[model samples]
Target: MDSLLSVCDIKEDVSYIIDLAIKIKAGEIEDMPLEGKTLAMIFQKSSTRTRVSFDVGMYQLGGRAIFLSSNDLQMGRGEPISDTAKVLSRFVDGIMIRAIEHEDVVELAKYSNVPVISGLTNLEHPCQALADMLTIKEHFGSFKGKKICFVGDGNNVCNSLLLIAPLLGMDMSVACPEGYEPDENILKISKNFAKDNNTEITISSDINIALDNVDIVYTDVWVSMGDEAEKAKRLKDLKPYQVNKELMDIANDDAIFMHCLPAVRGQEVSADVIDGPQSVIYDEAENRLHAQKAILYHYLK
Candidate 1:
């Protein structure tokens, strides 16, 4: 893959990456696929999982990762993204950017000669979606015929899941408030993939309907980065959609709970549900390392 700006870029290689992640986790592959390679991680937005996972993942691959915050680069001083991408391409083997605007990462990828990975963006978090898929595959053994329900704000995570689930032969339902629904363009593309995969994609304001008989119940923080001003209003609007015991009961009996991480206990998900027996949040978090290792290996190897 040239770059993973969105799930569409990795549509044909999702399963391969997942399988490779499983092997990496199982210690079946010991060779350093990324030996001597250097990955430049540009972060306009700070993160816990994204930063640490890629740093450790590159290290584990016998390579190195350089962390560059917004203040650490000329891009922070108003340099054009294309210029930054070109300069970085000449120095690093690859580039991973976590930015506030999706367009910035797109520009970086368009100009960079090496592979560019979207660490996270306002529109989509493709790496998290990959890790999430790995977690689901571990729990259920397959993606085909499975259903996943996302509750709360239809944010970047929801958009990425919508892009990926149907392509992998799984149904996805998104529950969000009226004005908080996922991007219409992404929904349209997901619908086409769903049609060919024999899976369904649904978006609605009703949480109960979305969770009905679903295999996985997923949620993320209602107020994501750059939306602190909307926190109070978002909490009020999304309060009814929180993934609590009552909401979990609406799903299948054996349905597992999943969160992307850094969850607010009483907000997007309840303490009981996130820490409960059915919760696979930790496994999901750990898979970020393995999943990203596979991604780096795919492009940098």
Candidate 2:
């Protein structure tokens, strides 16, 4: 793939990266595929998982990663991204940007000769979705017949999950309040992929209906990074959709709980459910390293 801007960018190769991550995590793959390479990681947004994972992943693969906070670059001083991309492309083997705007990453990728992998963007978090799939496969041993449901605001994480679940032979459902749906264009594309893959995608305002019989009960913060301005209103509107024990109980008995990290315990998920026996969030978070390693190898190696 040229760039991993979206999960659908991988198309049928989703399994390749996921399985590679599993093997890499298991120490089954010995080669340092990214040795002697360098990745440029630009951050226009603050991060925890996305930052540490990619930085350490490069080190583990015998490559180097340069962290460039937006404030440190001329691009932060109003330099055109095209100029920045061209300059960085000559210096690094690949670029990974956690951007506030999806269009910025696209513009960078459009100009750069090297591959650009999005660490996170307003539109999608493809890397997180890859690690999520790895965690699901590790826990269940297969994606066949699995049903994964996401609860709360259908934000970037939910959007990426929607694109991927169907492609991996898992049915996906989203439970959210009205006017907080996944991107319309992304939903349409995911539906088309689902149709071709013979899987299902469901969006519902009723949490019970969406969670019923699902294999995974996933959630993320109701208010994302750029949504803090609307925090009070979002908190009120999304209060009913929190993934508490009661809400999680609607899923299958074997259902796992997940959240993209830096989660607000009482908001997106309750303490009990997120810290419960079935919660695989830590494993999910660690897989970010391996999955990101797979991505780095794919685009850079």
Candidate 3:
């Protein structure tokens, strides 16, 4: 069985998959082939977008999405992830997991007979990145040579962007605090992919330098979910990197603002910017449905 654990897992085929999603969004298709299939969704992390989109996407495709909360499952009460995977594989056509550790997803895939998808992990958010890419394509028409700048915490979202952007020929710049830089191994791997694809990927501590002439300005919260204890400290250190009007001015006139929500209004992005005309946060959020439909179609078939 195949799985979508990272952006790298989809690789160069993302554009094709996203095109299918666009077709779905435009109402060009009626019956999706996975009519009788079942998607078992296991989410350890509480979410709005990921949970809703996958459940809705499966419904749209004529499939059933069974929501399995962490507390509702034996896996939450000390059962091994592999054992859970093995059991779920017997009942579901596919499994989607949103968890804290990336390894848990890997372990599930190891023992499962059915396909396993990574809904969200601490290390990468491949599905969200796919949606973001679809939105970018919708607005810009093409990703080739477009500079996308991401400012703030170099977390999972940033990590996926760094890895996936190169595959589509998009130049990417990430600006973050000194010690909060993206995973070095992931960075190195993406850089190598960038080199081969003729796309430049740069990471810097200087926010202004990264935003210069960038076509897209992306950001996430100073503190992600489950990082509540670090919130105060992160807000202090990351305030300088916030994407407000001042930071947006450094980018090109057409640069669009993007955030993977639940955005902290005054923290990672200003309210005026996120709620303003240029913001594509809602559009990004909506595309989650479309993009996952594409992913489900690809893997299920």
lDDT of each: 0.93, 0.92, 0.91
> Model 1, range 82-154, lDDT digits (tens) per residue?
9999999999999999999999999899999999999999999999999999999999999977999999898
lDDT, candidate 3, equals 0.91
| Candidate 3 structure quality by residue, lDDT tens digits, 152-191 | 8899999999998999999999998898899898899999
* Model 3 CA deviation exceeding 4 Å by range: none
Clash pairs (backbone) in predicted model 2: none
Query: How would you encode candidate 2's per-residue C-alpha lDDT over 1-301 as one tens digit per residue?
Result: 2998999899879999998888888898777778899999999999999999999999999899999998989999999999999999889899999999999999999999899999999999999999999999999999999999999999999999999998999999999999899999999999999999999999999987998789998999887887989999999999999898888778998999999887999988999999999899999999999999889877888
Stretch of 10 with least lDDT, candidate 1: 204-213
The order of the candidates by lDDT, greatest first, is 1, 2, 3
What overall lDDT, based on C-alpha atoms, would model 2 receive against the true structure? 0.92
